[model samples]
Target: MALTQQQRVELSSLVGDRRVDAVVAGRARMVLWRDEGRSAEEVAALAGVSRPTVNTWVRRYHDHGVPGLADRPRPGKPAEVPGSVRARILALTRMAPPAVTGLTHWSSRELANYLARHEETRVSHNFIADLWRQHGLAPHRSGTFKLSRDPAFADKVVDIVGLYLNPPDGAVVLCVDEKTQVQALDRTQPLLPIDFDRTEKRTHDYVRHGTTNLFAALNTATGTVTARCFPKRRGAEFLTFMKTIAAAYPGRELHVVVDNLSTHTTDEVKTWLADNPRIVFHFTPTGSSWLNMVEIWFGIITRQAIRRGTFTSVTRLTRAINDYVTAWNTDAKPFVWTATPSEILTKVRWVHTEVRKLLTNNDK
Candidate 1:
């Protein structure tokens, strides 16, 4: 009962954990059947099943090796381009706007087409999708994005953000940003219920009540949030946000991190800054709004509180947002980051690399 050279390789394929693989290996054993290799009754008793099960395993062993037993992640033809091309595809994907490739936007199919024609890399849209999943560049729906004018923006923001990572005792770390154009959209008719099979849908022409600006300062220590809702976002509006923080905690030097929007740096804002000696403004390098923690939090509100929600008017939207904020503040705690300064720096370095090696439309 000596095994063949092919059987070893077959065993290797079934070495990994899988149901059928284990069964194949179990049946490949020499002891499974009697000396005459009578598997009929032995298979029925041991497997508590049919005679064909053991016979199939014996027949398969005579045919292919372990690779035949193991399930191949891909079943079709190999690509013209190897993993290097797949890596290239990912590098292209991480670039801010995938549209520069004349794709309007990237779907896996578009990427596959680009690869097949340009790189001479043959792949299916399905394979491109697999690549997308691997790279964490899903871009399902307008991923949170911002473009900075400063070439040194990521480094600068990383430096400012580092202050929070290793903050001094009793120091105030504030994430300040403006949420502009928060609107109130009222439906023509109140949202009506639908059948169990479908979701509620609304017709166009919903009423727009009005909009408001939210200037918020998140206290990194106490996990408290202080915000001001204004008709417009201006230096004046930002001052109100700062003043709210000032009143809430007197005698604390505040470390406020804000975006580089013009309204946040108006002449009036600069004037207010001169008077506020205790306030330190840590501006996220221009165009790096994602560095603002509030923006991250705002996304949560947009998804959970705003998206698909029907508001009767701007006032209604405003009230709902404020109400959600009030309720949120009552219990919401600031997110704690465990990533060390080195880890954050490492990530920013990669972002810088992404910008440097950005794949152009031609690179496809």
Candidate 2:
């Protein structure tokens, strides 16, 4: 039967409408398939029904329009699962399993079993899983988070973020940090290179040559990095790097953003800062190394070079680090900081509130 444009539109709408009963929707889809020149057998197979069933729906759709697709009233018992019960099931899934259950979280099987055991609801694990999918709930997975407990988090955030967003004119703003104890480890055997249907493979064991510390100063304005490798991460090494960065941007005042390490705040470092008068230090809040943009550079280098690299000695490792830094500076872009101090503090406050609620619940 040829469908008018209006009939085709209505049939298409019924086939796509999720609010319609699935049986009705399936029948609508069958009619659409027939309209598209599919034989009854093909339509039946696609609809997972008999050829007669497909023919019946197509004929009914032709006779009675969309109403023909709905299931006719039949003499049978209604569904046993109550709406309230399903709501309760969803509510339970959102909550932690009771202490007696000895579960950190709920699996579909566990949740179904718990419901059956406690409230005597005869639900299958598959049914529970379907319910979860329909409602978009997942109780099985979790992520890790930490609250910054720094007292001066606000002040430090504004200071560092300020330099990143609006740097001082004529002064150099550098994010300085040490990637400490970078190890040179060679695989026990040569790595098997990847090919069709295979991954690159390396031996589990490795030979540790030694470790070196990379002190890097990331130029916030231009994204170029000035780096030096050191055998030690002492105040002396840090001061030397500071001087190197200072000399690199000669005669300009330097605004260095560093994490609050003991070495960074040592009396010796303090005296050097006083001597250099033009070099100013802005310490990131305790435990918040993410504020320093150098950490982002460290992540890039580690992922691109250090993590999977094979090195025989600290010298080779240093050479690799220098090579990567040199390449990075050639095309480096400054890591832009977009979060305002108020925005950051607002998010931290929300996290703090969440942590407090968790602690309170635990206490109860």
Candidate 3:
């Protein structure tokens, strides 16, 4: 729906400013009241503004017309780092480490020094940082972020999310991932097991008995979790896990969403997939295991079932974990995620440039 007359005037004057100016905002109501079918008092009450404020907007509109209600031009010193300086900074950053310039890695201080001496523009490290920030460049932390380059990334993303949002009419949607090296530990102090009144558990500190890999699948529609303990989580083990999923849902085409682990996409596995069309594999974007619902299930297992529990052997650890998973399945329910694809993509875009900074120093 289009905005109301009152809303338009208020928005124009408040666009650059963070908050609405009460007086200027009230004038919007006055302007609305003068429209073909509204009385001044009625418009004031409807717009939740005082009559004087309403009258002001109407009077200003009459005097200056459309641009009258717009915000005044904001005043500030023009940027010292003009277009030429910004272009030079970007160009320098994209070049090799400053060995040619008789220096080492481009530190903030060094870059600022070079700019003032060589480019004839003296600027502080903070100013250089701010300029780089405005362009979303931060080489110091550039490698920490990642993005996908799949040609069919968008379609694949929609398909993956759709499995959770609206699965096939009859089949179940399972989000799956592996949790590796889950250390079985006893805390430094034992936790007393709590009853219905409390959730704390008794524990005694014990040396960690190595680690176990957990393969988990969460039914998104039901919130039920099915887990398995494996010797080691390699491609062969992953193939076995896939077989388990197939057997679990006999005669049904199981839609499985997994991460981009190298083993998960090996040639043998791809051959198996080709041979069995019923099992569909949807991969999440690279470096986004957080998007997998099975990760959340792992957290629950850690908090409610595993932490502080004393286990001396793999058998006992396996039994305790199985008990927890069984109980969880009986009471499982789907998690609510309302984050829109647009919202996620917007956040990704904001970090895209900073992520690209790592590409600058090395052409290869």
lDDT of 2 by residue, 218-295 (tens): 988889999999999998899888888888888898999998999898898999888989999999887677678888
**Cα-based lDDT for every prediction:** 0.62, 0.78, 0.66
Output the number of the TM-score-best candidate.
1
- Higher-TM-score candidate among 1 and 3? 1
The parts of candidate 1 lying over 4 Å away from their true place are: 1-89, 98-129, 138-151, 188-207, 351-364
Which TM-score value belongs to model 2? 0.59
Q: Write one digit per residue (lDDT tens) for candidate 3, span 164-260.
A: 7778987777888888888766455433221111212333335677789999888888888878998798889888988888888898878889988
RMSD of each: 14.7, 14.6, 17.9
What is the TM-score of candidate 3?
A: 0.53
Q: Sorted by TM-score, highest first, which candidate order results?
A: 1, 2, 3
Quote the lDDT for 186 in model 2: 90
Q: How many pairs of residues in model 1 come into backbone collision? A: 9
RMSD of 2: 14.6
Give each model's clash number. Answer: 9, 0, 8
List the candidate 3 regions with Cα displacement exceeding 4 Å: 1-153, 191-206, 353-364
Cα error, residue 310 of model 3, in Å, equals 2.0
How many angstroms is residue 265 displaced in model 3 relative to the true structure, after the best TM-score fit?
1.5
The deviation in Å at residue 358 for candidate 3 is: 14
Ten-residue stretch with the least lDDT total in model 3: 192-201
Evaluated against the true structure, the overall lDDT of model 1 is: 0.62
